[model samples]
Target chain A: MSGATPMLELRGLRKSFGDEVVLDGIDLSVASGEVLVVLGPSGCGKSTLLRCAVGLEPLDSGEVLVDGNLISATARDASLRQRVGMVFQSYDLFPNRTVLGNVTLSPMVVQHRSRSDAEEQAHSLLDRVGLWDKRDSYPSTLSGGQRQRVAICRALAMRPEVLLLDEVTAALDPEMVREVLDVVIDLADGGLTMMIVTHEMRFAEAVADRVVMLDQGHIAETSDDPPAFFRDPATPRARAFLSTFDYRRRSGRASGSLTKE
Target chain B: MGGAEILFQGETISRLLSGLMVTIRISLVSVAISIPVGVVVGIAMSSRHLLVRAVLRAILEFVRVMPQLVLLYVVFFGSATAFGLDLSGEAASVIVFSLWGAAELGDLVRGALASIPPIQYDSAYVLGLSRMQTFVHIILPQALARLMPPTMNLVSRMVKTTSLCMLIGVVELIRVGQQIIDFNRFQYPTGALWVYLAIFVMYFLVCWPLSIASRRLERRWAA
Candidate 1:
């Protein structure tokens, strides 16, 4: 990821929700097609950072640049949204629409693609995520994992330059988590630029090109070698968070291998 | 027995039917006009400008509290006297009902719009949908589905309230019933009672389906 052009950059990004500082002076950048995994405890501003990056939440201070162009304001240019796709923790699919409709909406509505073309691409994307059969199904009918997978396809359908996943699998059942993570793993393999917020330590270790530990509204620790970072974290906060995983592993609460089918 | 024969009279029946037509016309026209007006007003209620939302909210609140009869008088007698324009009773009825329906529907729409989760808006924004596009493609479909039952309830309410137009001399259903009673007062002492009962049945026949439909919709969408 070194010396690559920064596809997404957050310079001095600051946000607050009425005295509770959520994100404070966060500066980070992702190179084109690099997968950056963000790890943190609850209320560490990980979700807020992704929300700010996509302009869902207004910034208290600072700038977000995509391809080195300013996109800092809460009211960003409409075209810029096509550059960043976001998947929410709740799977935020439009309940009224069919799975095909959910995946094809922005492409047809925003990109103004022909119905045939949008559906054609939508079919391929759904097939990629192994949800082609569920195209006619509504979000309500699909499982939590299926819904989140469809959401990922919805974001991917836009052909965004940078995809932001905010705890995408956090809402899934234990048995369902692997299916969604597999879809994400495929995307990472395809060389898509992604910044994911997750608690799946094993999956983060396996897939992330670089790992960032966000603590108290700032980047407390970052390492290019995710395995090393997991094995031996440099910061006290990172060590504490990583140790929780060890405890979970010892207690058999978490899977030791994310690749186990 | 005398009024029972009057019930079979073609003249009395036709008079009631024509009054029914007038009532239906007023209700249909008012709904058509008010729904669009309400939608516009409702969308405006969500505007970012504090003053715009505040003013619209104030007007809707005032309309909600003020009686329809009072609004009818204000638009009919008050406007006629103040502006020196001789408005027809039908025109006055349409105007007043429209204003009332718009106010009621606008509030329904505002509440429905508000009831949508904030995350939906965030999803739309991140997907690059324009505000109008978001409302049309994303927000409106879900909101409208939820709005239908209450909106149908409003339609039934409006249909029932068209009876009030008699006070403005619109000669709607209730007015014709009054005419029948007065004409038969001496010949058939029980005529008033029968006429009112008939009016009650007519209202039920027209509005019952709407109430049933609203309830069915609530059940259907609840799942």
Candidate 2:
């Protein structure tokens, strides 16, 4: 890779809640058009890392540079921060707004774009996500998968420099997870710069250009070859973490045995 | 005398209607002032600053603990002797009720805002919305829905509570009812009973619609 400024860079990021240190000093960077997937145990600060990077969580001591511009934790540069979009585990679409309104709100309100322009882009994004028909529907009316797709569309409406996905499918039903992940995988195919935190091993292996495993608030392992890393993790901690997932055995089977009618 | 006859005698119905108008004026003016002030205070109550929250909480509790009658007395009578600033009974009622309404509504606003999930704010913030934009476009709309029912309840409560103004010689609905009763005590004989009954219906007429609106909103939003 050339020595151009990394798309998203975090230097010595540290965060704590009260006395409990959730993230120790950590440094990481994602190159332009790179798809980096973060894997970790439940409390390993993977979500916090993404939150800090997006300025949702204040960092204890660190600097976040997006395209080489500093984003302070306290006084965030709104223009710089706008270039990073994030989707949460719970698809937090505005409950009061319809799907189309949710996607177009930021563009019209923050970006000061004309309503027609914003709605036009929103239409195409919703169309791309197969949700154009559900445009006028409130978030409460949609299924978990459909709401998640609208959320992805909402983030994409910003035309973010880098998008952060925080366990986007963790709240979905088993049958619904594949649909959300498929939309994300399609985004990866489109060469969007994304930093995703997920527990889905196979999806991570399929979509990640680089994989980083976090443990106890630190990066425990990094692998440029995700397939090799998934097959044979370099560290014992990563191996144990991957072992906890039953994805390999569960891949080709239905959830449970069914009795003959 | 018949109940209908007692109500019709000497422009009694007109007198009561004028008195009801006074009651509504006080309640409406108070509500109009309180809703906006209360909403602002409630937003302040939800602030992250320790001192701001504490100070607002103390004010909220003080208003909650003190009886509305006592507040009316303090503002009406106390301000006169203490501050040498005489206030009209209607003005005093307005001031007292507005303060009490704002405090109550502020607490309700605070609760409604708190009930919104933190993820809602996060989602707006990550989309590059400024704090004011997030509040106007996202938080306020959601909080307003949750706030409607309780706020309507407060309005009815204020309307009913405006009867307290009679004690300060405000000659509002209840005072007018008393005047009618005193004047017709011997002639109508049973006029006091009918007069009080009419007052009861008058209050019911004013408050019942407010409560119905509140319940309907609660059901619609809950669904």
Candidate 3:
């Protein structure tokens, strides 16, 4: 543990799926209300680390603290998970639910809020994500971009201290990626503390306060000057990663090496 | 007695209606009893534990492959001989139908549960939803939506399958139709045919809306 006591902190976090090590001795700290972005090659343990920090995976060894409170430190993940929120790549909204229903579900179910209040909060979140017009629409009825946005609203409805985004816009079409990123940028501007795993170098450069590039389950580089990192990467892996950013394909199809085919 | 009236006359109509009610009663009761059982059993079959899953899968498969008529006979006749306790024809029908419905419904539930993306589970945990919260708020809703169409289809089939209960003397619509035919054997040769056609129309009316609902729901799923 550091003397400074960051809002979100990890110390020697280690995780493995069977024999394959997803994260090995990883460590980082984000100050209160920091917008941090993590970038890495495909399957380089970025998502796994996010999962561990958010309590989705049981860490083999290490400690995770949220606002100086223990969340997942080998024995007590179930208690600490409530303070963190995460958005998925596929926008895992309850398909049976409308946009409002997706956002209101946890508050209504876990927080035991009245339906009217939950729906009211849900509607405000939908409005924030610019999907208030589509609140009654089922997730299947919405466009990919809209669904991802609704997913964001669903997470935001939890009022979490730290929000985690894992390739949220990757599932979107190229043209629609901007709309989702624009919403994220808006959130960042509002000083929402976030840890985003993203491939959108341009968006990350614009919005993120700091960027961490991981290779083989280790932080290869960390830079606050996003433009400098893009222009002159300190590490070879970071250069290889940034070079893949293509501004050409209009559909956000990820013209890079990690094209989700 | 009359030229147009047969030996049974309109007797078949009244008996058939009574029988249809009995059949519907059995199906509804059985299905109500079966839903929870099927869901739990199917989940056990799909469980991560090898021994538990093996046992559940073996039993479900054995039951599924066995003939319903045979099971009905066992429940109707075997229970009487073994326990010296006899159930009424309708009660027997309900029990047998429940067993069948549970097996089928459980399979439907299991399939629905399995179809959910693993990522959804990951999302639930990451969102800080507790275990119970995930099941109630996340797993159940998604499974219910996935299972509805198939379960509705099975219910229609179950309604139609009640005809088989006549073999056990349950006095369902088919049994009533049979009794009327026996009485009017000499009067009208094809009276049975018209009665059957009426029954077919009634079944169609009962099932058509459910079928339509299932299809619409499926289309919505794709959307």
Candidate 4:
């Protein structure tokens, strides 16, 4: 990889809700085409970090940058903020719109693209995610996995520089998790830069180029080698977090690649 | 003269029909003004600013607590005495009802906007849609579905509430019915009962379709 500027960067991020601090003086970066997975227990500020990164949550004291240019964490600059795309735990699809409408709305409305061009791109993105046939269906008609996939399609349609996933599969049923995760895995394989927050240990091990374990609003451990970190975490907090999941037993299956149907 | 003969009295039926038209006119005019104004106020009511929310809440409470008849009196009689404004009964009724309808519909709009989950905003914002664009394309469309049933209910209420305007001497439906009954008191003994029954049916005819439409929207959107 060339030694160019990082695709995304967070500097001295500090956030507090009332007296309780959620993120504390954290600094991180995702280089171009890197998949950096954030591993943490609930309430460790994983979701908030992603929210702040995309300007959904205002940082108390921090700067978020895209391609080395400072963007506001307060969401003052919308066009600059659009460089990042995010998918949430709950598939927050627009219930009033059909799948096609949801995918094309931003491009047509915000970016002012022609309807023909937007629809053309939307059809291709939906087709790639296996949702082209359901383009006319409202979000209420789709299953959880299908809805999440459409959400991914919606984000990808924007052609964001970096995509953020905030425990996107946490709300899915066990059977549906793989279908959604498979889409993320495919995105990673295609070299899309991403910052993912997840509890899915096996998928994290498979996809992460680097791993950061956050505990109690602080980065407790950072692993440049994901496989080694999974095998032997350097910090007790990181080890305990991994122990809660059946990481060892699932280690064998981590090597298996997901084939797109 | 029997009740049938009283009904065919000189210009009686035509007068009552015109009075019903007045009632429809007042309600329709108020609704037209209320919808757009209420929608704007409702969005303002959902603002995060404490002062904006508090002030709007105060206005909403005032409108809700005061009876429509009292409002009519305040605008019609009070304006004439206090401000030297000799507003006609029709104009006063329009002013009073528009204020009342706009306030009620504004509260409904605020609730509809608040009912939307915050994630919807996040979804739109991350896609680079401005706050206005988000509200228009994403938030407003979802809120409208939630807003329609209650809004229809408000329209029906406004239609029925127009009966109160006659208290200000609007000579609307009820006033017309009274004039008819009083004119035939000596000849038609049971004229009062028939006239009132007709007025009741007229009010029902105007309001019932609105109620049906409200329920239909509620059912379809609920699904």
Return the top candidate by lDDT.
Answer: 2
In candidate 3, stretches whose alpha carbon ends up further than 4 angstroms from where it belongs are A1-3, A74-79, A114-117, A246-261, B1-8, B46-49, B220-222
TM-score for each candidate, following the candidate numbering: 0.91, 0.92, 0.90, 0.90
Task: Tell me candidate 3's TM-score on chain B.
Answer: 0.91
Name the better of 3 and 4 by DockQ: 4
Q: Which residue pairs of candidate 1 clash?
A: none
- How would you encode candidate 4's per-residue C-alpha lDDT over B29-97 as one tens digit per residue? 999999999999999998889999999899889988998889999999999999999999999999988
Candidate 2 vs candidate 3: which has greater DockQ? 2
lDDT of 2 by residue, A179-201 (tens): 99999999999989999999888
Clashing pairs in 4: none
What DockQ results for candidate 1?
0.64
Place model 3 in a CAPRI quality band: medium
Query: DockQ ranking from best to worst?
Result: 2, 1, 4, 3
Between which residue pairs do clashes occur in model 3?
A: A174-A251, A174-A252, B38-B106
| Chain A TM-score for predicted structure 2 | 0.93
lDDT at B6 for candidate 4? 68
Error of 1 at A54 (Å): 1.9
Q: Output the worst ten-in-a-row residue range by lDDT, candidate 3 chain B.
A: B1-10
Model 4 bad stretches (over 4 Å): A247-261, B1-13
Query: Residue-wise lDDT of candidate 4 within A1-261, one digit each (tens)?
Result: 367899999999999999999999989999999999999999999999998888888899989999999996675666785689999999899999999999999889878899999999999988888999999999988999999999998988788999999999999999999999999999999999999999899999999999999999999999989999999999999999898986455546655578854
Interface RMSD of each: 1.0, 1.1, 1.9, 1.1
Candidate 1 wrong stretches, greater than 4 Å:
A17-20, A60-62, A67-74, A245-261, B1-3
